[model samples]
Target: MALDRPTPVTFHAPMVLAVGLPPATLSRAGVVLEPSGVALRESNLLDLRSDSAKYRPLVLLVDAELYDFDPEAFDMVAQDVGAKLGVAGSAREAEVTLGQLMAALARKSAFPPPPSSADAKTDKWDFSEVVAAVAAQGGRE
Candidate 1:
């Protein structure tokens, strides 16, 4: 769906290690999944497990905004399609995304939808904040 948001969101925190490849960065905004894994960009699901192949797993680290719309059901459909494409992985943390699919979401709109009253106390950081922090720590996005 549309990637507009009030703040930023950190989509994933995967620490993938591979020889000769730069670190991969990933995050999610709305239904858009952006992986800064440019080195492994050429490798798709079918060739994922090969030693010489470069690819990252599709992992979900958050389940909020998209879940307000029943993300599990949406993930089921995604899983089915991924399976057909030889992509294997469990849907953890609950898979969800906006109905309108986009390639990527803007950084400012990365913040997840507002939290519920009970969950509002949880601490959250915007995507740019995290990215800047990571960059300060020698991590590229």
Candidate 2:
């Protein structure tokens, strides 16, 4: 009889797909992102949605000059797709935007919410304080 084996899991790579940026810009962006453990790709505005769905990138850096530059709208789109959006006028700015997003995400996951008082099923023994008080009084006088 053959033993059962577990299936391998498929995890998405840490990626950044810069939308509407030229290949030349992307080449520089790639170099900037090399040490951050994130792979960078360039996708035109036409394929933005499809590429976004496929990559599920941490940051979708966009060239604001390509179209109407509405940061708020892009932010909503990013939030809808579960990623942080970055609009860049230059390659260096894009790098900074990505860095800020990375920092924000790191800070978010580093600290957990304080434990709720109601959820804690404290096993503290009742009358323990009273017992301590009696002992301090030297055998109840």
lDDT of each model, Cα atoms only? 0.33, 0.76
**What are the per-model C-alpha RMSD values against the true structure?**
22.1, 6.8
For candidate 1, give the lDDT. Answer: 0.33
Per-residue C-alpha lDDT of model 2 across residues 30-108, encoded as one tens digit per residue: 8777876888878876777778888788888888686356666567657767877777777777767877766776798
Model 1, stretches more than 4 Å misplaced? 1-40, 44-104, 107-112, 120-141
In the range 9-111, model 1's lDDT, one tens digit per residue, is 5443322211111122122221123344322123222333452222232332222343344555435533543321111121221122211222233443587
What range of 10 consecutive residues in model 2 has the weakest lDDT sum? 66-75
Q: Number of the top candidate by lDDT?
A: 2
